[model samples]
Every structure is written in structure tokens, then in C-alpha cells.
Target: MKTVSFLTKKLGFGLIWLLLGLGLFSCEPDPIEIDLPAHEPKLVIATQVFPAKYMVVQVSKSFSSLAGDGKEMNADTTFLKTLAVEHALVQINFNGQTETLKHVRNGFYVSRNIPQHFQQRYTLTVRDSVSGLECTAATEMLAPVNFEKLEPEVKRTEKDTTVTLHFTLADPGPERNFFLISLVGANRKNLLPKNKIGSFNAVQEQIILVNHGAFTNGKYEGKERLTLETSDTLLVSLSNISEPYYNYLQLYQKSGSLMNQLTGEPINLPTNIQNGYGFFSAHNPTAQVFKISER
Candidate 1:
């Protein structure tokens, strides 16, 4: 009888151990679900000052991603028109003088005059008369970059012969410098089929263009070597950009990368506007035309 009791007790303990093992090793946790609160709308201002061009500022409001319905909203013309602020009082101050910008159409405000020189410091102020909200930003325009050499080298492959335009840029610096190299075809055609567009610059032309990339005076300060793969009649615009603009462009490039999306990284842009969201920057652009050989 004692042996039978002992065997029963051993069986009970084994079952308890098995149950405990299952509880410890085989149990799955319940997924966590967090409900985030909605976000508020903010004023967004954007502008870029370039040489020999009147300043144009775009004013708009940004909607919070969490405020809308479950369906994603597309930023169409109607949506854009709704966000546009047409009656904002925009002003620019420079050299102890202030000028009110004229509201053109949509949300764009244009200055009456062009930038005098590259070294002038300009201040931009935007006030929403309805909401009593104001935003201000400042930037100094840098001198335009001069290319030492721009020539094309042709290489014949088994499939096709390709031409690469080689560029040599000299950085004018005692201070840190940034540059943008923009290329546009005369006929408004793309250089390549799958060419990607670069970061946004407020400088716009009547014709469509493609930007190579934003470059900095890191190692190639004296004469940097750059190339563009093309065989079309291209217009190249090189601009010396302000530091804040440079920083913003760099942030944009990183945030726009596919790696950032793959890693689930938040792409929050760095804004230079005070009491607002967006950036106002200055740059000096010099353009030239390059004609490549016909294959």
C-alpha cells in the first residue's frame, strides 16, 4: 500500500512538472496595442533665394497624420488649395529697409526686386492676419560656384556608346560651403529612364529639370571631380547654398533614402523657420549649356 501511494505521488509530481514546463516555455504573449492621440496642424513656410531672381515664398498649413480618417488622403490640387494661405502678409527686410511682398496667386508671395548681391543678409517675416501667428527666418546668400572644367568623355560599350560629362568645381571658401548641381535638357526630356529626382529647392524654371545631388566641400575643395551620364543638350546650374540650406538638404537626402523606410525611421525634416514649420534659405546659381556628341 505504501509503494502504491509513493508511485501515485511520483505521478502527481511529474504531471505538475509537465504543466509548469508548458506554462513557462509554451505560452505566447498577447500583442500590445497602443492608441496614439491626434496631432495639431501647424503653419508651413517655404522659400529659397537665388541670384538674379525675385524671391517667391509659399505659405501653407500642414495637417497632422493622425487627425484624418483611416483612409490615406492624397495631396491633390483640391487638398493643396485648401491648405494654401493666400492673404498672409509677407515681408522681407534687408540693409535697413523692409519691403512687403505682393501676394500673386494660390499661396505664393513674390518680392518686388531681386537680390542685390551674394553677401547680403535677408530676413523674411510672414504673419497670418486671421490667426495672429507669425514666423521669421534669416539667411545670407553665398557666391555662385565656378566650374574649372566641364567636358564629356565617350565610352563605347557592346550594347551602346555612353557619354559622361566630367565637371571640376572649385569651392570658394573660408567658411564651410555646400553646392547643388542641377541639369535640365533643352527639350524637357529626362537624361535617363529611371533617373531619380533630388531634394526640393524653391528655385524653379519654366522647363523641367533633373538634379544630380547636393555636394559639400568635404575633401574636394580646390577642384572636385563630378560626372553626369548623358548625351543630350543639358543646362547645368551650379549654386552655392547657405549652411542652413545645406543642412536641410542633407537631412532630406538621408530621410528620402530607401534604407530609412526599410528600418522604419521617422523622416522629420529640420526646419529653420521660427514659430513655423519649414525653411527659408538663400543660394547663388550660375548656369551653362553643354552639348554632347550624337551617337
Candidate 2:
């Protein structure tokens, strides 16, 4: 009789646990619905003008982030082609003269006749015939600041050889100035005979930014050290850019990767284009090349 009582209690406890498990699994939360606001597409433009160089402008269209599948967007050639704004009228205005840019392939517009003048304001106007969207922006061409001197020191170690380039730049004046320093690597074999080093295909690049506040005594000095191989060639470029473009570059650099775009807060980059997105600016650049020794 006692054994029968024990079995009965055991079975009762088992039934109680089974019932609790079933009740827990049966409860399901209701689905949630969020009402997102409507999105409007805008025109996007990007260009940089240089003295004695042809002006080229690239135009495209922006789209809603939620319009496509929830995958990360890859800016491949095929995808970029779709975003290109075709049949657009692009023009540049300088000193009461307007030069219409000729459309090249894939939303690129070019004009070689419009000469870029330092400290002169140039206005860009872009009108898309298909979407009836127009945008205008103006920027002054900043003067090119050349490097005063570049002194390279080579340090050889058992593992590798590194070159340190010391550079100097004289401040134009007490007025505020912004500069961008770029260091890029290229293949020595890809250099065309009698061609400039800047024309070589760049493999990798690093950037250094300098603002007016960093200058002292009418001059600024900086250094960059890089480990180079035998087949590598380094190109150093200095660009004097406008303050607006400098702010734009700073915001762009702070924008995180695609994953951050999806999960974190969205960052709005600074743009000068009116009624559109993106930046239209002018800069002057001077570049020099450094060859690696085949030790």
C-alpha cells in the first residue's frame, strides 16, 4: 500500500510539471507594427575643381534605405550605374561667364574651357531632366600651398626598412587655412615613361589633416614614416581646401561602416548643395614622389 502511495505522488508531480511546461510554451506575444514616415529621393552631386585641370562633376540620385532588401548596400559598378543621373544639364558659372559641361559616359560632365581662378567664386548648377530636380552650389578656389621642403631619412632594421619624410609648409597669412595631406602607394612598374607620379594607379592611401589653429610662426611642420618595399613607390600630396570642404571631410570620416549605419544612429554629412545632397568644392594640390630603394 505504501509503494502504491509513492507511485501516485510521483505521477502527480510529473503531471503538474508537464502541465506547467505546456502552459509556458502556449503563451506568445503579439506582433508589433511601426509606422515609418514617407521618404523622398534627392539629387546627389560631387566634384572638385583644380587650376589648369578640367572640371568633372558626377551626379547621382539618393534612395530610401528601406526600399530594398535589408542587406548591406554594395556600391558595385552595376549598382552605381542604376543610381547615375543621366540626361542632366550641368553648368559652371564664373565671373558672369557660364560654361556648360559636356556629358560623358555614366553621369559624368566635363568642361575644359572653364578656367579655375584662385580665390574666385565658382557656381555650379545641375538640372536633371528626368526627375525635374535642380541644385546649385558655390565655392571659392583655394590657392595651392606647396611643400617648403621634404627631407627623407632611411632607417634599416633586420626585418624591414622605413623612410621618414619631414615636410614643411609656410602659412599663406594670418587668415584661416585648411590643408589635407595624402600619402599613397603605387607600383613602380605601372609608371608610364615620362608620366607624372600622380598618374600612377594608387594601391593604398593615408590622409593627414591640418587646420589653421595648428599653425605657428607662419609655418607648419609635420612628418610621416612609412615602411616601403622594393617595388613600391610613394606619392605625397598637399591640398589647400576651403573651410566648408574641410568640415565635410571631417564629418565623412566620422561616419562609421555599413554595420554601424544599420544598427547605430545615422550620421548626416555636411553638404553645400542647395536643394540636394553632397558637396561641390574646389582645391589646389601639389604632389611629389619618393622611390623606395632595392636593398
Candidate 3:
């Protein structure tokens, strides 16, 4: 009787183990197949015109984010050379005159004859002979806004030094307007060693955009703070930008996320170009240089 009882318990345990193994084997997952659409490359145009400066247009081709190993896209020389649209017919038209832009180097087109006048409309036309693609865009040059007053105050501590900038500018008029404020700091000649102070050899630039209709009192006042060496030179610039270009820039900055690119999600950035995928705009910047003084 004892032997029979033991055998019965052993058989019950064996049955349970067999059922568990079968259940595990039956729960295996099946592979799923997804159908992704083919992607076609497009022409990307980037051009910013300033008064009295030659208009340089950068033309390049956009590729699928999944083309190479999943890495962030870098605009290095090799990458630019690989994706540059070369030998393209680029032209700019303004005031009943059309000027052809010369292709300087890898995807860059230049035009020195196009007059950049305030409120004058300029049209850009680009045709790629190799790809049989054509695109066009139009933009008006915006006038520069002068700064009313720019004052800097410095505060130094044992750890770091901070400079506070106070600035003001008059509004153009009741008409809607957008502005971009830029600050650049460069090392002065014969300054202290770069190691003792922070490296100021490379120009550090900070830019901020003022939204349209942000000011109502016909005047704009703002303040910015920075950390820099005592002998650094600072350049402050105020630029009046068009509404469309401002929108484009705002969207462009948002869409520059690495995760967004890696996911292959489509983002339609605001573009003035017809049948293309970039922006063409013009602005004149009023700038002033200042020498940093100890306080």
C-alpha cells in the first residue's frame, strides 16, 4: 500500500510538469511583417541674404533617415560633398532684373548683383539638371532695427563672472513685425592664456527671436545675462525678420530633435519654397561692438 501511494504521487507530479512544458512551448510568439513605403529624396534649399553681402545659396539633397546606420546626421564636409546638388541653374530676380548665381563649391551658389532693398521682393529659381527637379520661392528683404540703448553690468564671484545686458529698441510701427537678437563674444587680442580663462577663441553666439505683436507700447525692452572673460569683445545685433521666416525658424528648431529623425516620423516644416523643402529669406542686421570693462 505504501509503494502504491508513493507511485501515485510521483505520477501526479510528472503530469503537472508535462502540462507546464506544453503550455510554455505553445505560447511562443510569431514574427510580424510590416510594409514600409519607399522614400524619394527631395531638394533642400537654404539661403539668407543680408544687405551689401553676396547672396550664398546652399542646395542639398535630403535622404532617408534609414539609409545608413542609425546615426545622427552631421553636416561635415564629407557628408555635404556626398549629398550636395552640383551644377544646378540658380537665379534670383528682383526689380525686373534677373541675375544668375554662380556655383562656387559643393552645393553653394553665389550672386553679387542682386540688390537687397528693403520691402523689395526677390524670387529664387533653382533647376537641377541631373535630377530634373525645379523649385522656386519668393521673399522680401526686411529693414534693420537699431538699438536704442545697450548697457552691460558685470558681477564677479570667486567661481565665475556674469555680465547682464540691458537693451531697448523702438517698434517699427503698428504693422506686425518680428525681430531676432544675436549676441556674439570673441577673445580680444593679447588677452590672458586660454587655459587660465575659458577658451574664447571660438566665437560663441546666442540668438533669440521676438514674436510678432509681442510689444504694444511702441517700444521693446529686454535683458540678457552671460558669462565671459573680462577682455572679451561682444557684438550685439538686431535684425528685423519676416513673419514667414520667423515661423520657419521656430519650426526648424523644434524638428531638429535626434529622436524625431531616428523614428522616421514625417515633419512638415514651414517652407516658402514651392515644390521644395527649405526656406529662402533676407534680413539686414544692425550690429554694434563693445569692449568688456571691469566693474
Candidate 4:
């Protein structure tokens, strides 16, 4: 009598069948599907640059769940169309020291001689002339980031150029937070460095931040490495700090509402944007020279 073995003829046949199935699976193309929900708009009230910049809040009319849709609608025409529907204004009261506000193109107020500092207490009073609503929240500019080193980094590739920034603070849990980075002209002479780059007098070049970077940690103990292509110096300030109790962007943007690009959900930004100083070094170096101070 033949004894049945684990790898007997019958079992061998079964294994061969299984191997054939796995082979088919390997040969088959992986199922690839794209899923993106509808994208709500981000109410963006922005200024070109200070000292003669136009201030306007823009609301995106449409957004896609993925980059394709977002990229398609992010053209100049769509942005201009969005700006046509909103208004914005920023009023400041430094310890009840009233300052005259003027509305520029986007309802943002600018004065010829107004300065901001972390030491100076300030309150922002905004009036939505279009909706007849007002956002008058108050917060002084917290002391700017005290970076260990803020100079530019040059490497083999232009993209390797860097600005090492570090600060002292504990992490805000593990949930990630988003930060908006921008590089604006430090002076009037250095406007629009892209079209005519490499041939201009720049006191400090701006990196021209067009988007945001989301990170999991909050505090930078010593320094962090940021890689990019820049040709100017910058005054760097980062915000949109989602702490345990404070949501900055949600506090602002009343009309169009803030949309989560990831979730495609709408949020009424409390302050919308806690405007301080120095955004990211967009793509250049000397966007804004951020001066770090200490207590």
C-alpha cells in the first residue's frame, strides 16, 4: 500500500495549480485607480508686497481632489475671477493707538509709514466691506524665529541651495501642521526676479513661495535643512501654527472659506492667516532678510 505523503503526487498537483495562479497574478497589471473628492476653495486675501503692494482676497471657484484639477484651475484667469468676488481689510491698534487704514485693491489696508515688530503689541481689525462683516482679532507678532544660521547654502545643483533655520520649542504632538512659504522682493529694484534672473541688484532675493509645506513636528531645536534653488537673501518667518488650542488660518477668511486640499473640505479660517513677517525663501535667496531676536 502506498503511504500518502505531504508532497505526494496529488499535493504536488495542487501546489502547481497554486503556482500558476500566483504567476497569473504577477503577470496581471496592478489595479490603479485615482480617487479625489471635490476641492473647495481657499479664501486667500493677499498682498503683492508691502510699501506699494495690492492687497486682495481670492476665493477659488473650483478645486479638484488631485493636482491635475488644482493645476488646471490655478491659472491666472481663475485667480482673477476669484478675486472679483471678495474683499479684505487689515486694521491694527497698537495698545489703543489708532491708525488710519486705507483699502487697496483687495480691501487690505496699507500705510506709508507703518511698521510691525514682535515687541510692539498690535491688534488687527478687519472689515469686510462686501459682506458687511468684521474680523477684529488681536495678536502681537510673537518674537521671530531665532535661527542658528539663516544664510544661503550653495551646492552642486541650484536646487541644492538652502537656508538652514532652527528655533527652540517643543513639538506640537505628532499630528502634522501646514506652513505657507513665500519669497517677496526685499526692495523695489528686485521685483519679478524670475523673467530676468541673474542680472539684477538685489539687496536680498526672495524665494517666492507659491505653496505650503506640511510637517509633523513643531519645534526646531537647533537647525533643519531646506533644499531649493535661490539666488538672494531672505527674512524668514513661518506661521500657521496649529497648536493644541490655536488655529491661525481658520480665524481669518470669512467669505470664500478655507478648503482643505487634502480632504477637500471647507473650513472657516479663524484668523485665516496670522500675518507676521518673512515667508519662505520662495525660489531665490534674498526674499526677505528675517532678523531673529531673543528675550
Write one digit per residue (lDDT tens) for candidate 1, span 1-295. Answer: 0000112226778899778877898665575698845544456777755555677898876654333321223324565577778879999888888888889987899874855666788888998787666788887766666666665555776986454556766555565656666656522223333436433222221122212232354224222122334446666677766656666655554342221211111245666777676677766567877565553
Model 3: how far is 24 from its true place, Å? 12
Question: How well does candidate 3 score on lDDT at residue 115?
Answer: 71
- The CA lDDT of each predicted structure is 0.58, 0.69, 0.68, 0.35
Per-residue error (Å), model 3, residue 295: 8.9
Writing each residue's lDDT as its tens digit, candidate 2 over 27-124 gives 65565698966655567777856456678898887755454432334334575577788899999999899999999878889888877687899999
* Each prediction's TM-score versus the true structure: 0.62, 0.72, 0.73, 0.40
- The most accurate candidate by TM-score is 3
> On a 0 to 100 scale, what is the lDDT of residue 170 in model 4?
37
Candidate 2's displacement at residue 106, Å, is 3.8
Q: Candidate 4: where are CA atoms >4 Å away?
A: 1-71, 84-90, 106-108, 112-121, 157-295
Clashing pairs in 3: none
Error of 4 at 64 (Å): 12
Model 3 agreement with the true structure over 1-295: per-residue lDDT tens digits: 0000112326788899778877888774575698868756666788866567578898877666555432234434465477789979999998898899999988999877777678899899999999887889998888778888888776777987667788887887878888877777732222334326332222222565686566647777877666565457888788888888788766554443322222222666677888777778777788888777634
Predictions: Cα RMSD each: 14.9, 15.1, 15.0, 16.6
**Best-to-worst TM-score order:** 3, 2, 1, 4
